[model samples]
Target: MERPELPLPQLHAFVVLAEELHFGHAATRLGIAQPPLSQQIRRLEDKVGYALFTREPGRIGLTPAGRELLPAARHALTDLADGLTAARQVGSGRAGRLRIGFAASVALTVLPGLLRTFRGRFPAVDLDIREMTTAPQLAALREGSIDIGLLREPPAHDTELGFETVLDEPFVAVLSASHPLATQRAVRVEQLANCPFVLLPRTVGPSLYDQITNLCIAAGFTPQVTQHAVEWQTVCALVETGLGVSLAPESIRRIRLKGVAFRRIEPNAARTRVAVAWRKSDSNPLVPRLRAAFDQDPPDGPRRRPNQ
Candidate 1:
C-alpha cells in the first residue's frame, strides 16, 4: 500500500484529540468547535484509509492504528515547535552555541572567574571551550573553529582579528627556596644575569621568548639558559628543583609548588598582557555575551603592553 501524505494541521489536530480522548475537551484546547475538530479527524482517517478512533454511544477509544501513530505525531509536533523556538531565538539574538578557545596560562587567572559569572548570567547559551596555544587559537578563530580566544597577547597574524585587553599582569621571577636570590627583597633582571635560566622553547612563540631574552640583554648580559620547557608549569617545576630560574606571569603563583618562591621582577621588564580576541567580521549575536565574560574594569595604573 502507498503511504499517505500527512498534513501538519491535521497531525496537530490528531495529537490534541489523542491526548484528550474526547472531542469536546480537544476542541476547547485547540480553540475550535467540536464538530469541526471531529470533521478534521474524519478527513485524516479517510486520507490514511483507517479508523483512528472507535466511537461508541458515550465513549471514544484509540484503534490500533491510532495507538501506533500517536507517538510519531507527538514527536513531529514537538520537533516542529522546538525548531521554531530555536529560529525565533536566533532571530532575536538570544540563543545558539559559542565556541571559545584559551591558552592554559590564561585559564588559571581571569578565565575561571569570568566563566563563573557568564554561566550565571546566560544560562541558556551553550558554551564550548577548547584549550589551545596563542598561535593555534588565532588560527582556529580565523578558520571559524572557535568564536573567541583568551590569549596571552594579541596575535600578529592579520588585521581581521580584533583584540580586547582582559588582564594586564607583570612577570615575576620564580626560584627554589635554596637559591641565593630567593631571599632578596625584589630582584632585577640584571641581578639574575649570572643565574641559570629555564626558558620557554623558541618554537612556542619566538617573539615572546625574544622579549624575555632581550629584557636580560637590556639589563647588560645574556641569560644562561640551561633548559627549554614548552609550557609555563614545566619551566616553573624545573626551577623548583633548583635547576634554574624562570620569568613567568603573576598568574603562575596559583600553581603553589612546594619548593617554589615567587617575587616581583623589578623594573617590570617581562610584564605581559592577556586579551579576549575574535574575528573582526564575525557578527554572531552571542558575541556580546562572550565579550561580557572578560569585560571587567581596567585596574588603575599603567597597564602592561604585549611583548610585540
Candidate 2:
C-alpha cells in the first residue's frame, strides 16, 4: 500500500490536540474553530492509519499511536529549525572552515594573535592552517585549495590572484652571540662578503633567494654560501651554534633563539615583506574580515627591490 503524506499542518494539529486532551481548548490554542480542528485530527488519523485519540464520557485521551508519535514529531521540527539556522550562518560567513597557508616565519609574529582574535569573533570557523613556502602558497591559492596565504615575497599583479603587503620591514642579520658582528648595533650588508652564509633553498622560495643574492651583488661581493636549512628555526639554530651567519626578517626575532643576536642591516636594501594573497574571485566572504585584522603600517613603508 502507498504511504500517505504526513503534512506539517496535520502533524501540528495532532500535537496540539494530543497535548490539550480537549477539542475546544486545542482549537483555541491553534486559533481555529473546534469543528475545523476536529476535521484536521481526523485527517491526521487517516494518514497514519491509526486511532490517535479515544473519547469517553466528556473526556479525551491519547491512544498508544499518539503517544508514540509525539517525541518523533517534536524532534523532527527541532532538527529542521536548527538546520535552517546553520545554513544562514554559513551564508553570512559566521561559520565554516577557512583554509589558511603561510610561510613558517609569520607563525611566530602576527599569525598567532590574528588567529586568536579571529576565533574570538567566530568560534565556529575551523582554521585549517598549513605551513607552506611562498611559491607553493601562491599555487595553492590559484588552484583553489587554500583561501589565504601569508608569504615572505611580493607577488606580481595577476588577474587571477590578488596580493597585498601586510608588513614590510628591513632584513636583519642573524649571528651567534660569539660572532664578532654580534656586538655591533647594525651590520652593513657589505660587511658579510667573506663570511659563510646560511640560507633557505631556492626551491623553498625563489623570490627571497633572488632578493638575498641581488642584495649581496649590489654590496660589491658574492655571499659565500655554506649551508641551507628547511625552516626558519633551523637557520637560527645553525647560527646559534656558530656554524654560519644569515639574513632574516626582523619578525624572526620573535622566535627568541638562544645564543642568537639580530642586528639591523645597513643601507636597508635587503628588505622582505610579509604579504597576503588570495584568489581574485575568492568566494569566501571571511577574507575581508581577515585582511582588516592584519592591515597595519609596515614599519619601513613598503619593501622595494634590493637593486632599487
Quick one: best TM-score, which candidate?
Answer: 2
Highest-scoring model, lDDT: 2
Q: On a 0 to 100 scale, what is the lDDT of residue 231 in model 2?
A: 89
Residues 199-268, model 2: lDDT tens digits: 9998888889888888888899888879999888999999999889998888888878779999998877
lDDT of 1 by residue, 13-47 (tens): 99999888988999999999998898899999999
lDDT of each: 0.81, 0.83
TM-score of candidate 1 to 2 decimals: 0.81
TM-score of each: 0.81, 0.84
Minimum summed lDDT over a 10-residue window in model 2 is located at: 299-308
User: How far is 204's C-alpha from truth in model 1 (Å)?
Assistant: 2.5
